[model samples]
Target: MRKRFVMLTSASAGALMLALAAPAMAAPEADTIVTFDVTAGSLDITAPAGPVDLGDGAPGSTITNQLGVVAVSDTRGGATSVWDATVYSTAFTNGALTIPVGAVSYWSGDSLPGSETGGGTFTPGQPTTDDQVPLTGTAITAIPAFSHSGGTGGSTASWNPTLVVRVPITAQLGTYTGTVTHQVA
Candidate 1:
């Protein structure tokens, strides 16, 4: 009985040592964090859809056509405030024959970026002036054509203005080319 007891105690001690020496079976877990930031909304202006063709007409003739401009904003939450857009004719030239700025006229009566089929009128009061030419290159004369202001982000406005060109009797017979620019502030 003493021998048997001694053997049993020795086996129990060996089992305890093996349990203490072995590695833990459980795994520890931890968390990882992440973050970022976004920039404010923005405003954009697109070029006119067409070249605003006045077509072929005899000198002293008033050629009329429509010019369109589209403005947009990215502020979807309605944080955006007042927006003013102005339109101007840069210049028109037929090679050596230059058309004076005063010869071009802009009229407005459309609602918020009016269009031809949009049911807006071109009553010629927006700019309150018939002549659109600026005295100097840096001085841009605004056209009394478009009317668009104040909007939330993702808002869009269109300006379909009437462009009238008075062909000077002295205008040399040829094709004329020019550009119109839209500015937002």
Candidate 2:
């Protein structure tokens, strides 16, 4: 009887040891997830400084001046790849001595101050309406779009445009002023 009791107790202890040694079921693999989101970048432009102050000119004389256009990217995602510059002009008026928009022409050259290296090809603009025209000449009629190549730091570029106005000998003698508008995209 004593031997049987000892054997039973040993069997019970072995069973308890085996149960404790078995591996846990991995706790059902508790899982957690993470995520990230980003927003799109944007573009911006600065209009040329005004009162360009052409000073004075004689009849048939060509008055020359320059305006600078600057483009910038906020770089939210990356550098801007390309951009376009659009320009237009309102008729010049010295209290109604009207100077038609056709009298003006513009051309661009050299990366002006604050401009990046990837200078772009420029197409002249033409008179398209009483109030609007391209920046270059009548032939192109559209502002030339440029690449951000040439290492423009992926964010900013600038241009300088020389504007020419032929003052008709008939232009009534007085101070004249007009509005030139610029847009970028």
Candidate 3:
């Protein structure tokens, strides 16, 4: 009976030791992970529909323009934003994106008090000042503007504006490209 009792006690002790040592076993192995995201994109600004029919009256004549969505956002209420607009020329890959080639015969204010064909009415993509380009001067006459939303509930702000440019027919006779840039401060 004593021998059986000792055997039971030893077995019980062994079982207890194993139960306490189980947690000390090291985990199988470690793992590795990697991640990535996207930002910035190429923009395509089209001369909005109702493009001046090339043969209706005069191709690229009596010109001025207004491009909508002057700017865009990727995230909801993102602090940073992108602005865009299309011009008569599809590509202004000129050393810069905007060019100067003519004289501004007239200037128009923002408030449009008359009809679309009236004077003093702001043409979003035309010169706002009646500027003249000298034989040795720049030709970009008007500069447009960009309005960026601050946040979900904040007032928006205007970014770099477009330069009003004059393109006198007598200046050149071929398709010309222009470019201008705006850096946020």
Candidate 1: C-alpha lDDT: 0.58
- Predicted candidate 1 versus true structure: per-residue lDDT over 33-64, tens digit per residue: 98876556665666666766767788888777
> How many clashes in each candidate?
4, 7, 19
Q: Assess the local accuracy of residue 164 in candidate 1 as a C-alpha lDDT between 0 and 100.
A: 77
TM-score of candidate 1 relative to the true fold: 0.58
Per-residue C-alpha lDDT of model 2 across residues 1-185, encoded as one tens digit per residue = 99999999999999999999999776856888988877665667676567777667987897876655544443434443455666667778899688877787655554546556333333223222232223443323545433343233235656656667888878878878887766655
After aligning candidate 3 to the native by TM-score, how far in Å is the CA of 163 from where it should be? 19
User: Which residue segments of model 3 deviate by more than 4 Å?
Assistant: 1-5, 13-44, 48-55, 58-79, 82-139, 143-185
The Cα error of candidate 3 at residue 12, in Å, is 2.0
lDDT of 3 at 121: 16
lDDT of 3 by residue, 105-176 (tens): 222223232322211112333334443112112223223322222232122221112223344333334444
Identify the candidate with maximal lDDT.
Answer: 2
Residue 145 lDDT in candidate 3: 29
Candidates sorted on lDDT, descending = 2, 1, 3
Kindly give the stretch of ten consecutive residues in candidate 1 with the minimal lDDT sum: 115-124
Question: Which of candidates 1 and 2 reaches a greater lDDT?
Answer: 2
